[model samples]
Target: MNKIKKIGIIGAGNMGEALISGFLKSKIFSPQDVYASEIIEKRRKYITDNYHIESFDDTKKLVERSDLIIISVKPHNVKDVLESIRDNITPEKILVSIAAGIKLDFIRKNLPEGIPIIRVMPNIACFVREGMIAICPSDNTPKEKLEAVKEVLSILGRTIILDEKYFDAVTGLVGSGPAYIYLIIEALSDAGVRLGLPRDIAITLSAQTILGAGKMVLEINEHPAKLKDMVVTPGGTTIEGLLEMERGRVRATIIDAVIKATERAKELSKA
Candidate 1:
């Protein structure tokens, strides 16, 4: 049996709904086991209608009903959400915050003492149960409690344990990584269209190519550089594209993008 019998999501926005979708899809929990609270009637209705889960605008009631509460609201709205239901959150309940840039200490400060809070950085892929989730628990969070969070997260995707210090980078790299890949996909689709492929075919080809390449890298268990060499046969057309990418500084630019996003997350933490 799952330790998490009832789970409540405080915000039924994109990430929250995605979590709900992935969780139910995993069959680790059923619709009756899920709960959500969304201020937006349309989003709340969507969750209830599609997932058939109970949801309301009352965060306090949601907290009361759920033993495992997920704070999935936006970073800017985190403080307000915490404030509204801090008293209802007891030590027994495990609070998991998925709002990027929010630290364990900040959530700890907002809640009563002894609340086992876990900070998780989950990517957009959680919508499809293929996310890479990074988890860091607060000081003194019980080993079993941490494990419980991990168990819940495992259904969504891979979970890695790390120090809280690395969370901002995880937020930048994984939490925001999907968007970068999406941009790449979009560019590839456009490039295909420019090369005379139909738009729909271009999109499918671009998406599938990226997906296949990523799957190869994972399943092959070889260094990415080695994998790249495999694709770049002697004097092949791939080398021309690789050379152009080198000239365009694609590698360095991606590095810079992650760094910039990490810095921004740190800034948000301070705010």
Candidate 2:
């Protein structure tokens, strides 16, 4: 597909602002090429003043002016926004929806027939540009268009093209995964504090350790179990900690968390 010269975002919330920030910071699109539509006057003003991009209260106007339109509004608001822009959306404009639990077929049914639609599940980490994103395109979307969306998302972090069927699991894993990891970090910090470490130092060390371990898994491209074994020496403190965690069924609990979250995602999609 041809280069996407302009982008319109339908929300000015955290994720929407993150995309605008990512696009500008990556130099993929200049401020002039980006526009946002936000309902609140304060939010629109903030986007305009801070990002130096055009902001509107009218979704139709944003869609009319943009080449690529990102539906960044909450899932419940998606239908209304699509209804408002249905007349303005044409074959040339690419539509990408980042609203959680909103499927590609649902978007297709709401929009003009054969309008290219791409569904994306991106985590909150996007604000920091360390996001994990999953994209699934409708059958009508061309390969180039899908690639273009992926190219734009790559600016935020790793992008994976997956079948839409896996999106609920993706939502459970990477989308809600950050919160689980943050909880772990907090628990580790608490453990350190109990062991007599200063609170500030303990929190720093706990956060850094988790960050380094994640980096290792990504850079080394090795199975996490093998990496765990690498750190487990005979009669070591790590082994003792691992044993305690096993006794507490931490592994099973984490797995259950993902399973429960996936079920909730499925329920939300139906709503």
Alpha carbon lDDT of each predicted model = 0.91, 0.91
RMSD of each: 1.1, 1.7
Error of 2 at 233 (Å): 1.4
| Every model's TM-score | 0.97, 0.94
What is the C-alpha lDDT profile of model 1 across 126-242, one tens digit per residue? 989999999988887898888888998999998999898998899889999999999999999999999999989999999999989889988999888998998897988999999
**Alpha-carbon runs more than 4 Å astray in model 1:** none
What value of lDDT does candidate 2 attain over all alpha carbons? 0.91
lDDT of 2 at 170: 97
Residue-level lDDT for 127 in candidate 1: 85
Clash tally for model 2 = 0
Highest TM-score against the true fold, candidate: 1
Q: 124-220, model 2: which lDDT tens digit per residue?
A: 7777788999999999998888888888888888999999999999999988999999999999999999999999999999999998999999999
